[model samples]
Target chain A: MSRILVDNLVVTYPLFNRAKSSLDTQTAPLDAGEDFGGAHKRLVRDRRGYVTGVRALDGVSFRVEEGERIGLVGANGSGKTTLLQVLAGIYLPAQGRVRVEGRTTSLVNINLGMSSEATGNKNITLRGLASGRTRSEIEARRTEIAAFAGLGEFIDLPVSTYSAGMRMRLNFAIATAFEPEVLILDEWLSAGDAKFRKAAAKRMVEFVGQAGILILASHSASLLQENCTRGLWLDDGQLRFDGPIEEVLKAYEQDGNRLVGAAARA
Target chain B: MTPTTKIYDPHAARGVSGFLSDLWVGLSMVELWRAFAWDEIQHRYRRSALGISWIVLSFLMFVAGVSFFFAGFSGRGVESFVAYVAIGYAAFIFITGNFVDGCQVFTSSSVWIKAVSLPYSVHVYRSLFRSLLTFFLQMVVVIPILVWAGIRPGAVTLLFVPAVLVYLLNAVAVQYLLGLVAARFQDIGHLVTSIVRLMIFVTPILWVREGLEGARALAADLNPLTHYVEIFRAPLLGEMPRSTSWLVVVVLTVAVWGVVAMVAAAFRRRLPYWL
Candidate 1:
């Protein structure tokens, strides 16, 4: 069956309130009757203060079929997060279209709906509902979600009292409680302690086995190899390569090390 | 698999269903309001001795202070002053808090804004709802004080219901526009704070409009907030409403600002990077 599709997506964002220099101010009094030479000089100085736009995503296109696990690999600012945001419907594309089938849940920012002052139990309710779970569903699975988080007595206490790891556990538990048709995971997936890590890994494996589509964006090769069946490499807001996970990983490593070696020699 | 032969049709799964689903989800502002308000109250008094009772006590203190100050200055009887200032200040607090907080509603929750793809109207509605809850709680003080002071509210007091509703709608619209503007221009937050302070004096909160003669009275009558205050205060204090013209002004203001806010929110894609 068909799943998510993105076609020639282009998202541009404007940079507002650009800083102006004194040179730009001097040009403000230049009237039409001023000499052409002085006017040219004023125009040159004024250009420095003009605001500019940044293209976050430029003509990116990709697709994911049902029951597929795709790893989106890229360096920082490679449009990975932007692509995820677009897919999650947080950012509308400046150009192009994105379509997805079935229910989608994004773990892009795990602690998003959580209130720091609320008890862990209360946050479970709020964040769970925020992530698209029905009230009855959250109620039915509260115990299981809490248990999986391993927060123990702290779950009853205010979340502000919990350590960072504890908070992440709670967030992870709430996010994964519902079985979404499509799951989008950001860099936050590898958080928490070793024991929690093992449990999280097991939970992810269980989730992947249930015939859902997964799109993970991460820089870690081992994580991608372990979790994804296919890979798409991105560079500077464009898709660089797409292939089997192992082949793409090999190509990325070769190019990556070559740049490192050349820099070292230089 | 042949990389070229296995060409994926990128637009195969595109649909408008997701947008419609998000619109439905955005309408859950009431639930979000209840949840957040409970969290605010619980956190505020989590370890306090009297807990939620502090909400009542503080509101009483505010009314008492305003009533006494305005009573002495305006030379009105204690009973009339108490009834008038108590309800007037209560409504003012609701209106001011909503307007001030609404400006930062989106900016303060930048995390949630970036994380979820729901319609931006949810944030606006959620903030308005929370302010309404606080206002409702504060109204508890107004009722008893009015009754104890022997203020015989007239049938026109029923008008307070619609008046409050209009005030609320106006607050939401103003907040939506201000919030979007503040998101782009960080200076708008500080500007809104200063403006709200000025608005309190201009809106005739503690003083009666009747005290101001001719031109000043005309200005007071024409003020958008004057209509809100007088509509509720007149009936509760047993004075006739100044004019129904304020209702028309309120409706027009809401419609104009509502359109501006929706346009701003519809174009929020430009905002993430602006921030």
Candidate 2:
């Protein structure tokens, strides 16, 4: 029964211009004859001489039902992070509505809410608690998470003393320890050596298998193709294509190459 | 399944009821705050040698030092003066710590603030819990002082519980107000810190109220902070607080919460953006 419905969703963040205007009406102008009212007004220079807003998600909408894995493909600043944040309820859309009918958790950043001064085992409890898990829940999973991390005796050491790869292993294990109805991840899953990556990938596959709705934004075509059943291509904050994973990815890569070639020629 | 559509718009019209509901939702997340508060308390003592007991040791030193200097000047016996100053100083640390640290409640937890869906007021509670823990640790120092001063508690001392409850409510309200303001204006944190440091001298934490003759006495009577200190101090010192102290604390609690509710209603939705 778990599902998600996003209707005309829009997420905007202020672009503070310290010394100069951040907005460029010369390149990106409001469409003519369109009523710049309500949720449709994407951008305009405000009277406030310094700060303006960037419309990260502009009139974007999608729907997903149980057991649906949707891959999100977008270039930099194309609103993939903003969309994931919207799904996670961290960023409220400036316009439109989002209805999610299940417990949702986002693994946007595994290192979030972690203290470098805290030991690896303590961080498991810390992150578990921060993610809204109870003390006993974390305690029950502590051994498993520690084993999966493979840090062994080092788990007793503070995270500050651990290497980057070791930190990633601990973070990834803690993040994927719990299963949620809806799972959202933004690139940063790929970590550790090849062998560890394979293990991490296996864990993600199992996590996604249990989730009702899985949304992953990543640049890895193989990761998306291997996991997601459907794909969404985003450009300039707009949904460019939506279809089966292979088809959408094919079109997206073609468009990307074409733009690159054209730019090189010019 | 019916999909519930929720539109998040800071510009949307929000009334008193909306504010109350937001506060209720934040308050109901007891598990989150309990963990966060415990984490705050433990995080400080995690790597230290003496751990959280450091606060108790420090409190003892402060009370002993201040009592040595001021007891003889007050013309009261050192034992009674130590009891008076011990309660006042412990209560002083609790109240002023809330004021100064409350300003950083939202700012310090920006990571959780931007990432989590829990109530913003939960951070306020977390701050209060840390201060309360330290205050309790300092209160342990009071028992011995009370014994030496020969101040036996009567039934009226039970009023300490309600007085503390009221005091905590006021602390939460002020923390919310200051946290929101500080989040918006970073300078306010430093301003609050300076003001709290200055307030120790203006308020009667170390000095006796009876010794203040003219304008100082009026200042002590009018200062909201003085009432907060007395509400907790009087009970522990085995003396009943003046009814005026209770009235001021109660009125200030209501007024501060009223302002907090209004400000939160108007700006709660905008907090993430402001941050």
Candidate 3:
């Protein structure tokens, strides 16, 4: 029953302009004539004498149902994170429609999930409850997570004391521990070494094999090609291409090289 | 299976009804806040030798220090003055704690907010639970202080229960209000902090409200904190709270919640964007 249907999703974030000691970035204009009326008005120069918003996702729409392993490939600031965020219910769309019909958990930011002060064992409990899993579900997965994470005796230690790789392992294990119907991941897999990544990918594929959805946004081409069967390529906040993983990545890389080559000739 | 259609449209009409349903949904998830609040409390004490006991020790010290110095200044009997200040200061700190904490509630939880799709009110409840836990832990000292003041516990003392229930109800709404406001405007956080610090002087925690006159009496009357403190403090002192205090409490609660409904309707979704 888990499904995602997004229709013309648009999202915008304000650009805080500080003329003084802060870094001042230029205001990106809003593309007009979309279905949204009030959101289009937000980008006009305000009393602060600055264009207020950058449209992160502009009318990008797609749909996915149970058991789809989709890879999102895009450059920085190309709305990859924003799309995942909308799916995970972090950011509400400014216009259009988005329906997510299941329990979804996102590992978009690795630094965010675990409390550094809490022990790894406790974080699993805390995170499990936050995800609305039953107590028995959490207890059932606790040992398996420990074994998968390879934390061993380190599970009893506070997360603050662990190294970055250790935390990433724990986070990955904990997130995949209890099976959320829809799982969204960002580039957190890059934090681990190749062996850890291999083990994690095996777990993810196995998890998705059980009729769960996986939407992963990562910068690594190998990670996407190895795990995802489908791909979404985003450019400048627009959905540029969507198809088989190889074809999408091929178009995405060619366009990147084309832009760079054009710049060099200029 | 019912699909959860979460939508945002600029043209969608949001009024009081929209906010109430949003509040209802968030408030229903009690399990989320309980786990988060308990984790937060433990997180606060991590790596510290004194651990959770510091909450008790420091609260007792604050009550001893503040009540002792201000006891003679009130021109009231020392024991009664201790009792008044103890109860009044505890209430003052609790109220202001909610005010200050509510302002930073969302911004502080920006990490979790971005990572999870948990309801915004979960943060409000989490902050409220932590503040109430701390306040309750500190309020434990009030019992022994009341004994030291020679005040006998009676049926009237039970009034503290209802007063606190009202206090908590107002807290959820107020926290939602300030958390939204301060997240978008960073300056408001400092403004709220300074205003709370100034409140200690204007709200009559250390001094007697009964003896004031002229401008001083007017300040006490106009200050809403005066009524909030009295409603909680008056009960523990074994007297019925003044009818004016009850009226002010009820009226302010409604007014604040009314503002919350409007603000939530307009700004709740935009709040995450602002942060």
Scored by DockQ, the top model is: 3
C-alpha positional error of residue B263 in candidate 1 after TM-score superposition, expressed in Å = 3.0
Residue pairs with backbone atoms closer than 3 Å in model 3 (clashes): none
Model 1, residue pairs in steric clash: A99-B14
For residue B28, give model 2's deviation from the true position in Å: 4.8
Question: Which segments of model 3 are wrong by more than 4 Å?
Answer: A18-49, B1-18
Model 3, B189-258: lDDT tens per residue?
A: 9999999999998887879998878998988988999999898888788888888988999999999998
- In candidate 2, what are the lDDT values of residues B67-111, reduced to their tens digit? 988888886688989988888888888888888988888887777
Q: Model 1 in CAPRI terms: which quality? A: acceptable
lDDT tens digits, residues B163-225, model 1? 777776677667767777788878888887898788778887778776788989888876777
State the local distance difference test value for candidate 2: 0.78
> Candidate 3: global Cα-lDDT?
0.82
Docking class of 2: acceptable
What TM-score would every model get versus the actual structure? 0.85, 0.90, 0.90
Better of 1 and 3 by DockQ: 3
Residue-wise lDDT of candidate 1 within A77-122, one digit each (tens)?
6778888877876666778878867566676765565787789999
User: Which 10 consecutive residues of model 2 chain A have the lowest summed lDDT?
Assistant: A32-41
- How well is each residue in A186-256 modelled by candidate 2, as lDDT tens digits? 87765458777788768767876774678888898877886789999887788889899999999999988
Between candidates 1 and 3, which one is better according to lDDT?
A: 3
Misplaced by over 4 Å in model 1 are: A17-51, A192-194, B1-25, B47-51, B72-75, B255-258, B269-271
